[model samples]
Target chain A: MAQELTTQAARDMAAANGDANRRAMAFTPAVDIFENDKATVILADMPGVAADDVDVTLERQVLTLRGKVTPDAPQGYRQLSAEYQVGDYIRVFTLSDDIDQAKIKAAFKNGVLRLELPRSPKAQPRKISVKSA
Target chain B: MLQTVFSPRNNGDLFADMRRMQSAMNQLFEGTRTAGQSATFPPVNFWASQDSIVMTTELPGLTEQDIELTVKDTMLQLRGTYPEPENGDDITWHRHERVDGTFLRTVELPFRVNPDHIDARFENGVLTVDMQRPEGDKPKRIAIKSA
Candidate 1:
């Protein structure tokens, strides 16, 4: 089914840790998560982030996603109005033990990031066979 | 600032909580959706110089072929469709926040722009359109004489 799109202003990341120095503004990217029998997938929307600038790292049970974006205001132009601000994207996810950390894969295309986390073989459900003598 | 709130196993769905917060925010800013407001899908920002106007919007997961742009006098029209991802019945969504649908919007510029002088580019999922003012429409300065 096709649904109409709605505009939402980007939310600025709060300084919970009280960091003194921050070079650029950071916004949490909207994401979607899904799971099947084999794997769980995540999709994030981060516009203006180049493929080379995306960073995804899993340390212990935490998965971190970071994308840097260069300020895109055109030179020699005065800003008339702004509905959205361009900024870096950051979001973190805590993975479960069912996920296979070694087999996780990620791909970035058209400013969207797709992450695939395969379920660990030890955690997969298997059917038990019965033998009748 | 450190923000980490994606809990797939323990917290159920964080996107649902976010949606709840977003709906509350939407209620707080209820009057933003007034008539003639172009604040629809793919929010845009505008810039202007002495003789040109630049328009930009962010549209992730879309290519050049997916977008259509047309300029007629002072009206600029943008139309596009975001294709849905291919998924089988076996897949079940835990949190579906990313949107996929068709969008069409027409914006009226401050002044008429020549269609021939317009340039558009799609880079890193952001579309930028640069339009130069028509030569006949430029303001002419008058020289003052002193006696």
Candidate 2:
């Protein structure tokens, strides 16, 4: 059988609390978070992740963002040097009660995930939205 | 009896001096963490074959129009600019980690590449560059002549 064209390599997650059952390494993606009177927005960088491979879930007061990367090492090519490790991305954030849980919006483009958490109507009357989100 | 605590030599901003000293201390311990810890903007990975080489780097939230690629002999240059957030001054920042600025990285290929044959593609926020060596530079077997 021929080797797979694309493969996902696993790296050990740094400072990982003992989650021995986890298969692949999970990296905490770099993010930028900002808020206005009406809503809060988050942007995360998760390269090499396609739309279908990412998951965003909200449970209780925690919002989790996970992305799986499928790295393609060209066939028959030997890696000469690697300055960055390729792996999955995972990040979590705690949402306060002021946010409207049902109105959260998420969009992924160009390997960046934008999440918008609209403020609850009863919280405040001020208005703000992060551009398209 | 003791002399005054404020010396005459101090003239500049005290906070600026403290900031500089703090950064100098941070640099002293930065190298001990790992080999990948450096000031390089976007880290890269390289692969090579018999006649070709491939280089890739991750640059999220950027389109092809924001990047520039160039090759000169064995050096490959990549330059890119990240767009700033939509509203610069209005929003309150909760956490600011992503950076916005221009970055330039030049990598030396293992072999002198044929500039005309270089192919680059940007997809999923990753840039992949495939470069080929010139025909004359490829290894060739010489016929052994018996003297």
Candidate 3:
């Protein structure tokens, strides 16, 4: 059997609740991870989230992406029907040792987040020269 | 013997059964949820006012040029295409969850609206459409006077 490359492995992070605070629902954003010879790129759909509201953190080989979305209902309007739920987007990924932590770069535009994780020099493929004896 | 009893084949069968059951459950509960929650891409919310009807939807990874909106009678139509940025041959995909394709969403308004009075705006990937109700269709308040 061949290993499946596209894995939907992201799990929901439990919300913390207290008496004084109400926790809103958090949704898992759809993400795509693509790899080239130089880097691994991740693109996530986070609609309604502003660029400044997104937070990406890497700790102990765990990479977490979180974005806060503020509801944009017009004033003096009552919601009669809703098809999609309003909430924040959260996802986490476990990074392998082959990824260079220091060289990772991320950018957000038009509600899409792009993250590039460059491969370490040692992990890149190199051709070996052979001499005839 | 115990290892063989819990072999890879058995595990695979168990996972397959679980996946099948999950999808079956999803289909069972599909339409019971809110309209947007159960629908396809570009889920929308509808709001009503005395003089206008409003709708909003999220369309990430799209610009104004990628979307088209149309209003006909009491029907509102939305059409858009989300293009994939990377070429298939150039990169190896580890996880592909975001759908990229053309999508069409048609919603029927409760009341007829004036086509000329409709307003739409796309900001930060969210599209809001406001349709003004015809003057006669709006709710009217009648006054009672003493004879």
Candidate 4:
């Protein structure tokens, strides 16, 4: 609990100091975690990333995103002003067993990363009826 | 231009264009797909506005120098050559989705573009081009007269 609070505080501080890092990361990706009959979708905004540049791994219920930015600057560039640094990007998330990892699907379009995580049949919500005698 | 090097004026038909595109595709990206696969470019999403058109290509390991953009009267061309391969790298089973080569993508814009006003900026591995639409195509407000 303390660690979580610390991370939150760090994020708040980062937000307060807008230009502290110069590298922009969304404080939190707008994740619309939904439950249909089967799955949950995680759409992350990770712009400027290509399919080859991203690495998604799931181990022990932990999903991680690792990406390397291609140095898009020209060779031997004596840049006058550099704001965005080409570096590694990493993010991680913990998943519950209710998620059906096998049914997960991912697609990237227009810099948005979409992840569809289907749940196991047993984990799906169902309406139960109470019968009166 | 050397007359011999240029395609004969008579050979500028659709078939000749297809042949040239196919040959260029083969020379650019060879042996990546199936033993005998169809020709295609990797996935990308691009759009345009009234003032400028945007072409966002998925190219990892490519620098701005390796990429070039040229706009003609009605067409936008992008050619990118991948950076030099890592020195004597050994590889095994790898997911190589970063297709790299002398790729040339030519897209005819909806309207003409002024090459002089083409501006490009690269950030976070994405290149954003601000090409001014031809002056004639720009919208201008007309003077209203009393009826």
| Highest lDDT scorer | 1
Model 1: CA > 4 A from native: A1-13, A16-23, A124-133, B1-39
Residue B27 of candidate 4: its Cα lDDT?
79
What are the models' TM-scores? 0.76, 0.75, 0.75, 0.41
Tell me how far the alpha carbon of residue B74 in candidate 1 is from the true structure, in angstroms, after superposition: 0.9
List candidate 3 segments past 4 Å from native.
A1-22, A124-133, B1-39
lDDT of 2 by residue, B1-147 (tens): 444433445675677667867888899988777553367767899999999999999999999999999899898888989997767565888776676789998888889999989899888888889999899999999999999
Candidate 4, pairs of clashing residues: none
Scoring each candidate complex against the real one, what DockQ results?
0.55, 0.60, 0.56, 0.04
Docking class of 4: incorrect
Pitting candidate 1 against candidate 4, the one with the higher lDDT is 1
Candidate 4's residue-wise lDDT over A66-111, tens digit each?
5544544433323333333334455567777787778789876544
lDDT of 3: 0.79
Instruction: After superposing candidate 2 on the true structure, give the runs of residues whose Cα lies further than 4 Å from its correct spot.
Output: A1-24, A124-133, B1-37, B143-147
After best superposition, candidate 2 residue B135: deviation in angstroms? Answer: 1.5
Error of 2 at B22 (Å): 25
lDDT of 1 by residue, B32-142 (tens): 785433457668899999899999999988999999999999999999999887588888877666767899988889999989989999988889999999999999999
TM-score of chain B taken alone, every candidate = 0.73, 0.71, 0.70, 0.60
